[model samples]
Target chain A: MTGIELRGVEKAYGGNKPVIENLDVQIEEGSFTILLGPSGCGKSTILRMIAGLEKETAGEIFINGIDMRGVSPGAREIAMVFQNYALYPTMTVKENIEFGLKNIKVPKPEREARVGEVIEMVGLTEYMNRKPQHLSGGQRQRVALARAIVKKPKVFLMDEPLSNLDAKLRAQIRTDLIELHRNLGATFVYVTHDQVEAMSMGTDIVLLESGRIRQQGAPESIYSAPKNLFSAQFIGSPPMNIIKAENLEHGGASLPPGTVSLGFRPEKVIVSGEGRAPERGQISFRGELVAREILGDHAIYKFKTAFGCIHTKTMSGSTVEYGKWSVRVDAKYLYYFDEKGDVIK
Target chain B: MRSQSGVFWRTFGKACRLAVNLLIFAVFFVPFYWMFLTAVKNLGQTLRLPPAFWVSAPHWENFGKVFDAIPFFSMLKNNLVMTFGIMICQFFTVIPAAYAFARFKFAGGRFLFGLTLATMMIPAQLVFLPLFLMFSKMGLVNSYASLILPWATSSFAIFMLRQTFKQVPQELIEAAKLDNASEWKIIFKLMLPIAKPTIVTLGLITFILNWNDYFWPFVLTTNNAVRTLPVGITSLNIVDGGVKYHILMAGNVLLVAPALAVFLFAHKQIIKAFTYMGGK
Candidate 1:
């Protein structure tokens, strides 16, 4: 088990225009670290560099305190599962899982024993004779996992391995991966553009934006104390709505007077009951409910407020109407951002 | 009631498709039929008024005469040597070159590959005279080196193989690399296995082109020792005794047989190779 550390890693396709610049990250051993961001944020690039698939233009990579300079991907002692699974289509599931073993010159009987063990581990014993194309998306993903883990590599690098599966399968595999990590105790560095995957599966999340680290911490800490506006907006689902609102604080704390963009999570916002007024909440916005989406258990209401548009999720059984509504923002959930979109701590 | 016009239009479409396909097959297979007929026709029956479609007796001895009239065995050997040699050479030259062009990023690779593709558009005739002169200067004009050497380095093979190599997933190659495979193992074990279909197509094409080659052999070789099949057949056209039309046709059948058999068995793969390369 070994941790990966990137120090001042930078990459550019010449021309002095860097794709990833001055990036620093430290991933702990036996920890599932997800480099999460939107597309082209260079999360995948960082993963590739760690796998030695892509060369860093400038930086040093360390694995278990050993400098990983000028090392080829073959010698990296790391296994990577690609977004597409990247299984050898010509080989059967058994052969694909055994490819690395064969390459390392493992003896025939030991290789077969290891392959059989992983096949059962991934629940793919029945599909061992099948090719990758013959397997479903989820099954192929499992075969990829089986192939990676069978090697018992010091590090596992998965680049959006679950993104290709259907929604239900993605969620299912997410649970399976978390369980697998616990049992194996191998260090995992996962990269994904899906914030939900990062938040749910990663023990530590490294939020990236424009090829740089936006924030890094445990999932709960990053979710609650997001270091920046991008980190806050990116970490949640249905996204954190940003409304241009006035900080009309009469007696809170001494603050500068300037327009601030109010950020609050929709799940935290509550619609006041007909006769029951909201208390202990310092913020309330009155607006016309423009639209509503009833998603089985909860209904998300879209409103045109005085500040801007606000979205609040209320229980679907609640008797909220379309015309007028008062949404209460819990004081602790309200985040203020300056005009430049930086979080105003 | 089934509409009369709808039924008529449907029948007409089916007949049109059948007619078009018949025309295509005829256009492709007529020369082969004619060659086969000529190989078995006698001198007098070959020039008969109606152009003999059926003969009274099969002239099996005409094939023997083709061998008797010329050094058929030696000519066959030369053609086989050149064809197989070129094919084997291309297997080596094309696969690695293709892998490099498809998978790696080296300085000037794009410029070099572009230069290779640019050579494809230029006619072989344009380079024939200069290449012949260069080979003569190198004292390689009369040997098999003159025949097989120039073909051993092909731009088109590199181009075809590069397209095939590109279709192999980058992930597989990277996986192989991570397995402690040098680039050589990745090419031989991973890339080659995944690209079996494309490799067969390249081999067939390289064989066909070399077997049917005449102009290069005619220009470079002055004697029958190094002459390929097509060139050998042309020499049989104006032999010392007379125009041995039957013998010429027998030689033609021999020349076409191997290529025809290869194409028939692997036509789907050949067409797919064309489609794959054309798309690129």
Candidate 2:
């Protein structure tokens, strides 16, 4: 009953400027689905629509086999955690968690018990008496989550709930959220602009751009085989280098005699000995090292090539001389895009 | 000791602040003081110059005379009834209208709100005669209805309150809605608590205006039973043959006292309302 199925969902503001068109997604009952996109890409809008915060202009939303057209958000049994952590500033943590329960007319003792359980689940027992204004951003976010989960809602909608936190806090909360989902075994629809969050946290990631879904699949499959140019470009950090390719026949791409456009990850490029130039089963690019950023475990190198600039990374303790270098690329790791930004697969 | 220049400037600045405050105080108090002195004096000294900075003795009997000359108690009662009635009506009506305007997107809401604010520019004097004749035709004349009915709706109250309600986060409304709360719950449980200061400020302004109102109430009610305090004081002038300065001063003091006291007690809240209004 908790699984969500959206069929040809269309939304527009006032019958014009359609924001989302023909959005079809099916979420498994207990799966964590992340809606990943850039800001203003209608990711949050979809989450709001699912939560019933927004009315669907033209679509059918089904929870289990039940049509959701006449269902209110409260009756839909879905809860949402907002980006700003919309914890009632005037209400204490305990009261905030109990607000929906009280509204639903749950018996007082049961409401109290639910509040206590969710407060413990969120690790906010210490802050139960504190108003939201007294809590830090991370604590406020936890309170919002507690408010949502205390209802034992069928579907959990999170709209960038962790975006307001610091990097370290976001990472910590991400793991906590995964653990929480596992424990609850409830359907979770999370919206975020961070690809890393989508990759690590989503059981299934729905990537969006300009109000349309670019791709949707299991996180591993999406990371490995992004469907198109937008998916390939958006799914990874230090995103896939989209090099334009010349004429290529059947296989992947046929490199022109001199140098066909080649794409390779930084880790895929090997620092070969000067005598042993890059060989077969590998594409070669020779250029001066334009830039070097040594992150803790991996180093990203910017190589100035004839095509333009190619970004490749190397393992720690391996240093490339700036201003001049030759790189041996693994042809297996290469990605090719046509002049139209479509994958040449 | 501190340097003479630093001390001098510090003292000078302190004196400057005090002087500015005193000047402001005088600007407000001077007319009342003149009225008080004139009320106490006999006809000969009533208008005597540099305005009587001080009176020779307290005229305690003037208050009794002011009441004896006019049906002062009835007028006071009428004023209270009208002022309190208008404030109550405003409280009930303005909040809901304000809440709707602040939160909803119905067509013509902005236009209606605009139309409401436009009422502020309308001169009250222009409507005074028409309202009086209308009340006369309706047989509401010489009754408290004339004084209380015209004040039931205030555009300023709605405008002030909508601006207050607008500051409440949309997230809170959504949160309430998601809980299956009715629109009424969102207004009473959520909006009202947040807008308490504004309501009080509006109430105070309405009360003060009604309490001191002279023109409309005077034109509407001929008898003392329906007359407001300001108009009642004016009626006292005729009984005293325009020579009982002490009695008139006593009546003026009585009329002004309640408003002054209310202002003093709620000064902080008034300032806060003004600040909120200015911010909007």
Fnat per model, in the order given? 0.83, 0.46
Segments of candidate 2 deviating more than 4 angstroms:
A247-262, A271-276, A318-321, B1-18, B29-52, B55-57, B239-243, B277-280
- Mind giving the per-residue lDDT tens digits that candidate 1 earns over A206-309? 99889988899999999888777899899887778787554345324333345366688888887774334557645677778898888888878888876778
Predicted structure with the largest lDDT when compared to the true one: 1
Candidate 2 contains a number of clashing pairs equal to 5
lDDT by residue (A58-104, candidate 2, tens digit) is 88999867899978877888888888877676578887788788888
Top-scoring candidate (TM-score)? 1
TM-score of chain B of 2: 0.90
Question: What's the TM for model 2?
Answer: 0.90
Q: What would the per-residue lDDT of candidate 2 be over residues B139-214, giving only the tens digit for each residue?
A: 9998776777887788888888888888887888887777767777767667786687788898999989888988
Alpha-carbon error at B52 in model 1, in Å? 3.0
Candidate 1 wrong stretches, greater than 4 Å: A247-259, A273-281, A338-345, B126-142, B240-242, B276-280
